[model samples]
Target: MASDPWQGHDAAVLFTVLLTGVPTVVGLAVYLGSRLTRQARRRTTPFRTWRDVSLAAAGAALALYLWGLLHVLFLDGQEQAEECERQRPEGTPALVGRRGDFIPLRLVCEASDGRDYTVVIPGYINPSLTVLLLLALLGGVVSLLLHHKQRTSTRKKG
Candidate 1:
């Protein structure tokens, strides 16, 4: 995390991680869940299977997801580094004292493109919790379906 000695606050890393990590796991879980449910049916006709569809979909989703992750992890870091390298001259034109929204550009210099580069920092979203939430939801639905199926099967057995 890079910061000016003067700004006294920073939030670059937090946004970087959440924005990057969330979609990756959510997409994967949805893909696999839909697949497994379809595959496990007792007798499905040819040319249709849930497992096949889910797994196939995962490939495309994963590819697009990786590019997003890379942009967050790599490109954002590069931009933030470049942004921090240029700071405003110290004690010149005190933008803080007389301002709207009040950021010290003197302490934080703008990049060549007139954009402030942001550093990619670690964020809250991780695979474990995302998968857990997915499990809870899908597991509940599947359990209900399975219970219903079992009751039907049992009544037929009787």
Candidate 2:
């Protein structure tokens, strides 16, 4: 029987949870807070659209990150080990061990013959998350600049 790679690594699991969970929670909170505020005010500002788009992008990225984390932590290792065992050359013996990666999340299965089979968290996920994060940052900066400009212009007139 294959042992659980994550078993007995309480610190690592806790760290992973905190690293991903905090951002996810913050992103969702910001998104929901803005939505609720907009509903309460019942008026849209010039920068509101940009701000909302930024928050949406952040939320999407965070969701993807969490999904990838879930796959890495709970699903991939054992399945990939089984696949490796099946795919190994005949008479090569069983899978010997497995290893995991956190960033870009993946599992590597080691066979008795010293071959390694890697199962990667879908190719598009990390890159897509990165792009979304960049979009979110750019949109946030644009929104802030526009908001600041609007405030300054009003101040000058007043």
Candidate 3:
């Protein structure tokens, strides 16, 4: 048996708050600041194009997904650790397993009131989320470039 894995719960909670809450607050501040600055300038900016809106929406969606992912990876991680601890037998290690990159491996751990756990760590990243994040980034960049080009052409025409 291994030592208690739930000892790091406090640190994980702090890390989760820093990772998720800080960025969300910062993003909101930036957005509100930009809006206030634009309003103060008293410039009647033209409405954004549908494509531009769509790209921004995609970016927002990606950000939301990332927020959820962080929560799941961090907050849920702590919960899982606690659950494992609760199910663990007294005076036994929280984890007991082989330490090697070999097949036919076995891990002895308690989770969710179960006596055993099959921890399968995937070798590859999640392709779907990766693709979606990349697509959001690309769309945002393209939208910026097109908006700049449009502004330049409009200025030239005017």
Candidate topping TM-score: 2
lDDT of 2 by residue, 1-158 (tens): 22764321133663677587767768677766767674645877658778887888888887777666665555444565565566666666667667665554555666667776555467678799889999999989999999999999999999
Alpha carbon lDDT of residue 19, candidate 3?
77
Candidate 3 accuracy as lDDT? 0.46
**Candidate No. with top lDDT:** 2
lDDT-superior candidate, 1 or 3: 3
Please tell me which model should have the higher TM-score, number 1 or number 3: 3
Using lDDT as the measure, name the better of candidate 2 and candidate 3.
2
After TM-score superposition, the amount by which residue 24's alpha carbon in candidate 2 deviates from its true location, in angstroms, is: 4.0
Residue 1, candidate 3: alpha-carbon lDDT: 18
Stretches > 4 Å off in candidate 1: 1-48, 76-158
TM-score winner between 1 and 2, please give it.
2
Give candidate 1's whole-model lDDT.
Answer: 0.40
TM-score (all chains, Cα) for each model: 0.26, 0.62, 0.36
lDDT, candidate 1, 1-158, per-residue tens: 23432232233433454465466657656755564664545554222343334333443434443433444444333354443443434433322211001111111334333343222222222343344345455545555666677689889999
lDDT of candidate 3 over 20-97, digit per residue (tens): 755775675565456556564475233333333444445454454444334334434446454445555665544532
